[model samples]
Target: MKKAFLASMLAAACVSATYAVAQTPVNTNNGAAAQGPQLSADEYTAYQAVITATDPAAKATAAEAFLTKFPQSSVKSTVLEQLVAGYAGSNNVPKTLESADKLLQVDPNNIRALALETSLLKAQGDSATDPAAKQSAYDKAADAASRGLKATKPAAVADADWAAIQKQVTPYFYSAIGIDALTKKDSAGAIAAYTSELKAVDVAATTQPGPVLQDTYFLGQAYYTSTPPDYLNCTYFATRTAIYAPEQFKSTFQPLATYCYKKFHGAEDGYDAVKAVAKDNLFPPADFATSVKPAPTPADQATTVFEADKKEDPTLTKTNIADREFVITNGTTEQAEAEFAPIKDKEVKLTGKVVSIADTTLTLAVSDDAKQANPLVADVSVTLTEAPKVAPVVGADVTVVGSMASYTQKPMMFTMTGGTIEGKAAAKAPAKAAPARRAPARKR
Candidate 1:
């Protein structure tokens, strides 16, 4: 989460040219040029020492000395700003942070200083070991980022320059704010902050691996974990991240995309199309909700499957045992009677796993609904003509031949009598031998 610090860029840029008092006044304070404020010979000499320094370390030292020599100088804020840039460019962490604090004391809303503060504090929070220390750093980061959001264009920076500066720094501020909120478990606040960040940054940035891309994924998580969860929005944003995530990280985001899609739409049938659309757009399209088809409810599925089954086998002729079980169990009393009447007392062949067994009675789970139970339950009750020589164990796959007798609709069990096991029964596991008893120990 380290930021591309603006101060580092400013460092070399600051020392590249001599300060022209005409075009950009060196003695400006709070964005207002002083009325011909003249520097003393000594002050001018010190100012030249700072502005003419060829390197960040030298410039920082010269600027610090100049500020110490002329504490009440008209260009104090300017010197502090450059000093921050110089320390930042030289990667002097403590001095960079110190100079930024100094700059903020003179101009509380200095955009560059606030940005550096947020970035440095956020980095500190990320690496801190103690809970209190991390909390303190994140709190400070959020505060600085909040101020950066409200920072106005300095009067000295032209309109065009201000516009470019905003483009550069605004997303960084919002991202910091969002991260702090996310860490605090404030989902709504995180969502708002990250949304604002996406709005502020170049759309293309969201597709790259960095603050914007990471925040884009975080936005999805915030939406998903928010109260009463916004699944569709989560799907859209997460799908986008999965699509653009770097190869090593691609798998990280796809599962959330699929899971949230299924949760919202009731199935993952059309998620790829959504992903296809998300790849090119920053936000979901207008028809997003209407586009995905929600899967049928359980009752709806039963009704549809039953009706199709009835049409396919009007007289129950050639209807498979699984289909017969479905219509009889789930269909209305009248529909159940219509299907069951045709096959009454007729022998049928069924394939399923054994549910339970006694000497001459076998219970079998013969339908999808029956087999899906936590502990498999029987859909068919069979009274065998005689018990098999080798006992059929529970959960052993077998084929049963029996005459259909009667059935109950609720909790759906069909009674069948004069049954026989017709195929190879699943092999039983070999019995384990008892372990040898330990020898009695001599009295201690």
Candidate 2:
């Protein structure tokens, strides 16, 4: 969850010639009229002294002094910009922010100022513990980023430098907006912002793995958490992230990618194909299409099991509980009769969890190979010889000895008669009710 940092870009750009103050040609007409702010001899001397300082600390000191003396100077913006650069170079975050704000007051569209402010605000928002404060900071950061995105290149900046600045700051701007949207639980908004960010940058060409990879992961998460989750896109982006993620992150993102792919495809059959596609592409192919197949029905699964088991033992169809249950519940009428024929009038010992009781009939979910079938599909209906002394509680384990009387297949039930609870425990006392407290007296 580490947020991207653009402080280095801000610091470098501000001090470099890209953001240097515009220098006007010196006029030798000292005794004549001046075109712009004609600085006095001392003021001009101080300006030169500030700009020519060797180190950032000395530059900051000189710039502050110049600004203190010439508060209304025409070059105030220039001095403040220098101070911003100086403070940033010194790693003085508070003063750097303060200087950037001062520069913004004079030149609101200043790219360096806007970039620094937006990045700092986002960093603060990321670390904030209070939800309201965090949202407010992120909201402000996103606003600044929006304005920065529209900012025109400065007159003094070269075309190449401006392009480089754009390439660096634009992604961070979009990321701020997307992260804020994610915090607000606006998954669609986050996806839109992140998509715009990826389109703005060549993520596959990025040499650094931090920002682009992380944003790609976030984009996948946004898709996953959408109203109706876009599992296909989620799988694509998540797999792409895994392709570029660090070794530690590979293990983390791989499972998410696999799960989404499996959920969308209904099986793992084509997962290797998806991963191969993701390794070379940032987005899904234009011709991409996939369909989710429904899981097999219980009856279909039972038939599959029966067929597989019959390969080993031909007599399994008549003796296996699963095979018999499948035939009785899901097979044709003739098949049900064939399976039920041999067991008629035979005494069987059944062990299962009690599902429900009505008068003398107990519905049970018969267990097979130690695993019980779902209680809702109760397969045993035992008719007791007589009403017992105590009624058995639902979900209690019990053994019944009864003769198989009959069965119905559509709503499958196996009727047994002459049944009795082989062993029953004494019923425990009901839990005592907690004492209620008196209401507190109303204040006078």
Candidate 3:
């Protein structure tokens, strides 16, 4: 199966990478072709000569010149691939990534282009400060890894080389799998898959890493992104109930964190390297030193007495903020406003089914329909008091109540109110007070 898979991929790779080059043969008839933009025999020969040029500088210059002269060359993919490699080798990462992306744009499934793009994106991601952008880079790497796995040609690849490619690409596949598993809140499964990928990288790194090592490093990063810090010290790193124990992950994860920190912040305080991001993981300080603040004593406190007639009005729980809405109480649309208004400052329980989950918010539908109404017609969406360990699946039963509430447009949203996942129950109606009164009437 592996062989067959690789073979199919290789065929795809050829179509994407080399076929165009094969088609654009040099016209041998001297001036047979018009000199609009097409390559003549001499020009094609010159191009190939530059591709094979021993001097890196000369090759780059020649390739650039060829591209400038024949911007629409039929062998564009080939030219782009060579440029990517040449520029990358010259430490021109930006240009290398640009060329790699261009190659992908032309033939997205090209194996070499996919491989190059993955490496370049990973590199870029490592340097990015924006978490969103960094995550995007990792996503692109995962995509390239998928393409590389599918672009292999088993028939042409030597057995050893094929195995190596598998070792290299499997982490990408597993990294993606881990991310998906996390999305579903399958912590054990995600940790297992990510650990397997990390192990694979370790195995591959024993030799010259090539790409597998790079993939391993990025897999660790993705793991960090998907994993919640609170869970990491607890369930994630606990026992080997899933994949490896926390101890095992220490070698890769700690180093990865340190590397990421160092790369992002030069010699700054490692613990406080990153600026305060609301969503960033807050690992315990290594030395366990807590900064203590002075407390105000009763005698030192400033106090004021209000008039006997003074009154305190209740605060509004749900209000509009910017654009997005928030709900403090988790309940059906019909009950949300009332439920939140009375106990805006107090804790409450709301029940609903999952509708959708975005980065920071979860949309839930209250199953209010008895027979004729929509199941989620009165569903209410709420932002959680704490971010969920895993994204809840659509249609899953859930209950959320929290303290903060903000109103929104459309289906009207309330903001964050403190809450918990009370168990889901059927939206069954109360058993009709069964004409039981008829028996009482008889007694009367």
Candidate 4:
């Protein structure tokens, strides 16, 4: 992909870098391209030699000699453009970049030079060890690409030719912009720029193992990491990239797709259908977002439980400790108040893992969800009547009897007073584990 793109860039630079060289009456009284001032006879001969060189290396030398000898000539910018193209064609990396930089000094909005600068600088930024240098490279690349996008077509270039050049370089412009946004943690900006880049290229180009395909995965990551996250979009693009990736790379991309799918749909049972659909399309199909069944949000879960309750037998019962906690913690102001009304000041006995313990008060994780967090969270706090001879172990499950008191919803904790600890739940002996349950049970 690298060879092909740079080759295309060299080809474009060679053909499209031409200016009004050897025109009948070339003038540059202002040290820029103009048509009024006639070229001196000797100056015309020097310019002719530069254009007539055969080898790229020889061409570069001749162009440099012409520019140095005639620095104030009207054709300075024109000769620098040729020098940049010649170095690019010679496959000289440092020289190519140097000449392109010189060309930009003369024509700041030169599209060919900007495209080369953006691509090369971005490559350096990707592998840089110094954070400050890395950031500066991407910043400059993004700035150059931005200017390229707004560059005007010179009149000497025909409309048809300029359109073709625009098509060739526009993808780099958007890609450079996307990389800059991603480096700064601007996921929304990255998503917008990358989406435009994918649309600007041929659809087939996105399926190949190349910059476009890699950027497709980056787009999915941007969506997956965005605020509040668009899991469905993350699943779509990630699945698409996985379909085209080689076997060694397939595992890397497939896992991210599965993770996002399980996060949104709550299981992997229907994921094969998502993969099948993704294999045929670059972007998600029109109805793909709606077709995938989404798991309930926290608010939705709370609202559903509240709506389904009846006065005759409420879901917020002393026996239904986990359900009561779930609804109260996740529900809205009115819903939480309703859930808490019946349970407040009520003495309830429940078994939970001791998360933290103290002489006066300690916390416990009553619900399974809280217990499952990497570092367990306390959903229920108990104020003990007195500390025990031996303090309760941090991770041991025990039965606690306490009168429920105040609660906080956002952090989701329930405090109880005048509490006593029953003995710890028995620790399970090591044994052969049972068959693993499926995705929703995992909840991640």
- Candidate that scores best on lDDT: 4
Candidate 1 residue spans exceeding 4 A from truth: 1-36, 129-131, 295-444
Residues 231-330, candidate 1: write the lDDT tens digits: 8899989989888888877788888988788877775567778988899899888987788865554345445655766676767676656656666665
lDDT for each of the candidates?
Answer: 0.74, 0.72, 0.46, 0.76
- Model 2 off-target regions past 4 Å? 2-36, 129-133, 153-161, 203-207, 290-444
List TM-scores for all candidates, in order: 0.63, 0.64, 0.39, 0.81
Candidate 3 lDDT by residue in tens digits, 186-214? 66666566667656666324222223333
In candidate 2, position 9 carries an lDDT of: 36
In model 3, the runs with Cα more than 4 Å from the true position are 1-39, 152-166, 169-444
- Error of model 1, residue 362, in angstroms: 28
Per residue, candidate 4 scores C-alpha lDDT tens digits across 350-411 of 67777898776879887777777868899999999998777777787778889989889878
Candidate 4 global CA lDDT score: 0.76
Model 3 root-mean-square deviation: 21.8
| lDDT for position 313 in model 3 | 23
Model 3 worst lDDT window (10 residues): 435-444
